[model samples]
Target: MTTTRKPGERAGLTPEIVFAAARELLAEVGIEAMSMRGVAKRLGVAPNALYAHVVSKQDLVDHLLDDVLSAVDTQVATQDPSSALQALMVDTYDVLLLHAALLPAFLVRQGARGDNARRLGDGVKTHLESASVPAERVDQAVHVLIIHTIGFAAFASHPNIDSNGYEQPPAVLRRDFTVGLKWLIFGMLDC
Candidate 1:
């Protein structure tokens, strides 16, 4: 399905461009509705042209997610272990909320294949260990923190929640997230 590129249209076509377009499309239409053709159309390129950068739709999604995760600042890991972990959770929640449209896809594809995800996981595990969490429980603790952050972002961003008459204001949601995260951290430390 390859076609001759129109002058000036595909001149600057690159993986970065493709990824940015895909991310925008994902945010606008969601994972289920996003398509290579749609992204290509968004970029003013032929659908097959995207294959030069992304092998398939799944690859595009993976790249998009990795890009988003890479934006998270995990430097809080350098601070006191427990406080660092709490900070990381709060930061992660904010990042996920910023890309709330992608949370559902991210939660389902929990496999940490991307470099950013691996680095974030490593930081969390290291912090947990530094906090003196049992070696056997480090993995569980990390999973709990990650799942809780993603779950809250996903639930909060759902459209039907407002129509269902259970909507909480953003301030209240943030307060609840902080309270719940604190409790989770306390429980992990107590164990």
Candidate 2:
């Protein structure tokens, strides 16, 4: 027998719950195959029930990106602008690594149009300005940093294995990212 929800009756459904279910669904099936019906199946609800909270699949994906990015720490830890910028980038990398499945979404969406994303961008600009990066070059610097961070995280998320299938250790991956970030930061600041 099929059960239907009455009008205006949520049955404990909320945007948060929907987002959680959608994220789980994405993790299982990946972005290309994730759909409203798939999310509804995961949540034990009708597909139309999801529309009550999420407008469409793209909307759900956008919101998921923002939700994942909200965990990034945008705070500057040191007075030295370069160090502070590196810290922020490392934090971003860590957060993205944790939600590695969503990294492709970032590539397709060109980053989220949400508060958290704006905050991160603003933090990057603030650090660059503090480091005396020329105003005209700040945007370019920001792009370079973002591209590096995201690209590195996406590449590192996969198993870095040898011909014998021996995967590289996690510490090596992190060290490589930080070292590269440090070099990139110094290069941007010196110019």
lDDT of each: 0.82, 0.87
Q: Which ranges in model 1 have alpha carbons more than 4 Å from their true place?
A: 1-11, 159-166
Please report how far candidate 1 places residue 142 from its true position, in Å.
1.2
Counting clashing residue pairs in each candidate, in order, gives 0, 0
Best by TM-score: 2
Error of 1 at 97 (Å): 1.1
42-78: candidate 2 lDDT, tens digit per residue: 8777788887777789999999999988998888768
Candidate 1 overall lDDT versus native: 0.82
Poorest stretch of ten by lDDT in candidate 1:
3-12
Best model per lDDT: 2
lDDT, candidate 2, at 114: 78
